[model samples]
Target chain A: MFLIVGIFIIIGLGFNLLGAFSLYRFPDVYTRLHGATKCTTFGTLFTMFAVVAYSLGRLVSTGEARFAVFIIHGAVAALVLLITNATGAHAIARAAHRSGTLPARAVVDRLEEKEEAKGGTPR
Target chain B: MTIYIFLFAAALVGLLAVAVLGRLVAGPTIADRAVALDTMNTLVVGLMMILAAVYDSVVMVDIAIVYAGLSFVGTMFIARFIEGEV
Candidate 1:
């Protein structure tokens, strides 16, 4: 039980750390959003999984109902994180684009091109 | 032993959140700062969930859920502000 829980925690911390580092490593907003959003979401998912696993192990060993409550609540928090993180990222990206922040060193900007094709001025 | 692991993980995650703050302070553009803030919010949620396990409190997990929802709304408002819609 300790090994399973430990592995999940380590994996989560690793990814979370990577996400933080990416904020400094990426040069622009869009790229940073890509790294920070995806990595942190994945890391948090693993952390939640670890918590659920721990609760399940305890529930099985001690037959406690509180551990079941822990499991369900932890799962709900994870679901909320998963859904909100993605939507927030999309909102941020769209806002950034509309607010006149262009991607740094891009080969092609399909969104800008598409907007131009529709006769809308690219910001 | 198990408690030590949870505590250590929580501490490390908190450290990562602080590290992300560097970008929040130094980001050259509003969009960059917004992205950093969003990342920090996610980290905080993760930290709350871990702390819930450390303290053996289901109520902490419930708080995490509420915090996540509130932060999402805050992020949306920031996004709208950036778009000049508000």
Candidate 2:
């Protein structure tokens, strides 16, 4: 159990570090968003799972009711992360693009083209 | 054994946050900085959970949950603010 928890923590931290590195290295805001959101979300999932596993292990060994509470709440928090992170990423990316921050190496922008077709803006 | 692991992991996370801080400081655009802030919130919640575990406190876990909920709303607000919808 300890070994498994350790591995999960290591993986979570690895992904987080990678995400931070990508945040520094990525060429544009979109790519930075891609790295930061995805890696941190997934990494957080691993860390929360390890916490859940540890709580469960304690619940089994000591039969403590509070450990169960910890497990449930940890799971809830992880679920929140899973759901909200993606939607937040979408919101941020749209906000960035709509505010006119285009990607650095874009061949085309379908959203822009559609907006142009709709006569939203003359440019 | 377990305490050490949690402590080590927390330290690594702190360093990771510091790395993200570079972008938060240096990002040219508001949206870029917003993204970094969002990432940091998610990570801080994770750190809170780990702290809860280390201390054997159910109360801390509940706090983490509340923090996550609030941060989600804050992220949306920042997005809308940047988009001129707020």
Candidate 3:
């Protein structure tokens, strides 16, 4: 049980660190959003999985009902994190584009092209 | 033993949050800062979950859930302001 929890935490830490580093390494808002959102979300998923596994093991060993409650609450928090992170990232990206922050060194901007085709100026 | 691991992980995540703050400070545009803020919120949620395990408190996890919801709302408000929709 210890080994399993340790492995999950190691992986989560690595991915979380990568997400932080990406914020510095990426050149623009879009790329930074891509790295920060996907990596940190995945990392948090693994961390929550570790917590669930730990709680399950405890619940089974001690047969304590509180451990079960811990598991349920942790799972709910993880679900909320997953849903909100994605929606927040989408909002930030759309706002960035609409606010005139273009992707760095892009060959094609489909959104801009579509707006142009629709006879609306790209902001 | 397991509690120590949880504490260590929480500390490492806190460090990562500090690292992300550099971007929040140095970002050239408002959008980049917004992205950094969103990342910071996610990291804080993860940190809270790990700390909940360390302290053996379910209430900590509940707080994490509420924090996530409130941060999402804050992000949406910032995004709308950036888009000139508010």
Candidate 4:
């Protein structure tokens, strides 16, 4: 049990740190958003999965109902977070694009004035 | 055994933190900063869950859930503001 708990903690922390690092290393808004969403999502998944594994291990080892509750609740929370984070990242990316934060390395401006000029999309 | 796993995970987290910090400090635009903040929020929730496991308490996990929800709201609000839809 102790070993399981330790494993979970370490995994969780790794996920957390990687998520933060993505914020620093990504170059443009779109790329940064991409990194933030993907890495953090994966990190969160690993951390929460670790928690579930630890809790389940404890329940099996000790036959405690509390451990079961912990697992269920933790899983639920992780699910909610996963759904919300993905959608939120998308919203931010769309907003960023609409507000004029173009890709730093982009060679094309089609999403900018060209779309509106051709009457292909609403401004 | 578990202790070794935790140590390894924590080490990875530390490395990720260093990389993310590099972006936060040098992000070229406002949107990039916002994105960084969003990622940080997710990371914090993960950290909270790890703390819960470390202490053998369920409270930390609960807090992580709440934190994740609230941060989602925050990210949406900021996105709206940026979109000028607020």
Candidate 5:
């Protein structure tokens, strides 16, 4: 049980570090957001999983209903993290583009064209 | 002994958060800093969960839930400001 906990945490930490390093190394804001958001979200998934496992293990060993609260709450927190991270990423991406943070290798810009066609002025 | 390991892992995450802070400080654009700050908030929740496990406290996990929600609001507000929607 404890070993599973350790493995999840170590994996989570690795992903977490990768995202942070990618933020520093990525060439531009959009690319950095891509790297940071994906890696960190995945990393948070594992860390939260570790918490779930810990709570379950405690429940099994201690045979108490109190530990069940940890299980449910930890799972809920993970679900909340997953949902909010995606929404926040989209919000950031849209805001970045609107604020004129263009990608480096700009070959296609269908969204910009579509937005302009809608007569929405860039603020 | 197991709790100590969890403590060590949480401490390691805290150190990583500090390292990521360098990016927040050095990010060239507001968006870059915002992205880094958002990632750091996610990591803070992870840290809080690890501590909850170490301390064997259900309330800490509940706190993590609230923390996640508050941070999400903060990130959205920053994104809204960056979009010039404010």
Candidate 6:
């Protein structure tokens, strides 16, 4: 049980590193959004899993009710992360693009150009 | 044994937080910074959960849940502000 929890934590760490690395390495806001959303979600999932596994193992080891609280609360936290992070990332990316921050390497900007062709600004 | 795992997770989260900070700095627009801020909120919640396990405290877990909900509200409010509807 301990070993399993340890492995989850390690995986979570790796995810965190990837997310953070992308944040630093990406050249633009769009790329940064890509990294921050995916990496953070993956890392957060692993960490939450570790917490759940640890609590369950402790529950079995010591036979306590409080472990249940950990499992439930941890699960809720994970769900919140899933729900909020992806949507928020999308909103930010859209807002960035809408506001005229183009990608560093882009061949076609259908969204922006289309909005312009329609005789109005990209709202 | 268990505490070590939580500690490792915390360290990783800290690293990730640094990455998000980089985005906040390099973000070309306010919206990009908002994205990083949102990601940070989730990371903080995860960190709190790990802390709860490390300390063997259910109270910490409860606090994490509350924090998650509140952050969601805060993120939405910020998003609204960014959209210029606020």
- DockQ score of each predicted structure, in the order shown: 0.90, 0.85, 0.89, 0.56, 0.81, 0.67
How would you order the candidates by lDDT, starting with the best? 1, 3, 2, 5, 6, 4
Best-to-worst ranking by DockQ: 1, 3, 2, 5, 6, 4
DockQ agreement of candidate 2 with the native complex: 0.85
lDDT of each: 0.92, 0.88, 0.92, 0.74, 0.88, 0.78
Q: Considering only N, C-alpha and C atoms within 3 Å, which residue pairs clash in candidate 5?
A: none
lDDT of 6 by residue, B1-86 (tens): 67876787787686666667766786767877787787788788878888888788888877887887787787677767776777
Error of 2 at A23 (Å): 0.6
Q: Is candidate 5 or candidate 6 better by TM-score?
A: 5
| True A-B contacts kept by model 4 | 0.84
Interface RMSD of 1: 0.6
* TM-score of candidate 6 versus the correct structure, residues matched by position: 0.90
Model 2, B1-86: lDDT tens per residue? 88789888888887777778888999999999998998999889889988888888989988988988898899999999998987
Q: If both were scored by TM-score, which would come out higher, candidate 3 or candidate 6?
A: 3
Measure candidate 4: CA RMSD. 3.6
DockQ of 4: 0.56
Tens-digit lDDT track for model 6 on A1-123? 878987888888787777767766777878777887898788879988988998898889899888887788788878877887777777777667666678888888788778889887644
TM-score of chain B of 5: 0.95
Q: In terms of TM-score, how similar is model 2 to the real structure?
A: 0.96
Which stretches of model 2 miss by more than 4 angstroms? none
TM per candidate = 0.96, 0.96, 0.97, 0.81, 0.93, 0.90
Q: What is residue B81's positional error in candidate 1, in angstroms?
A: 0.3
Q: What DockQ class does candidate 1 belong to? A: high
| Clashing residue pairs for model 6 | none
Could you tell me the C-alpha RMSD of candidate 2 in Å? 1.1
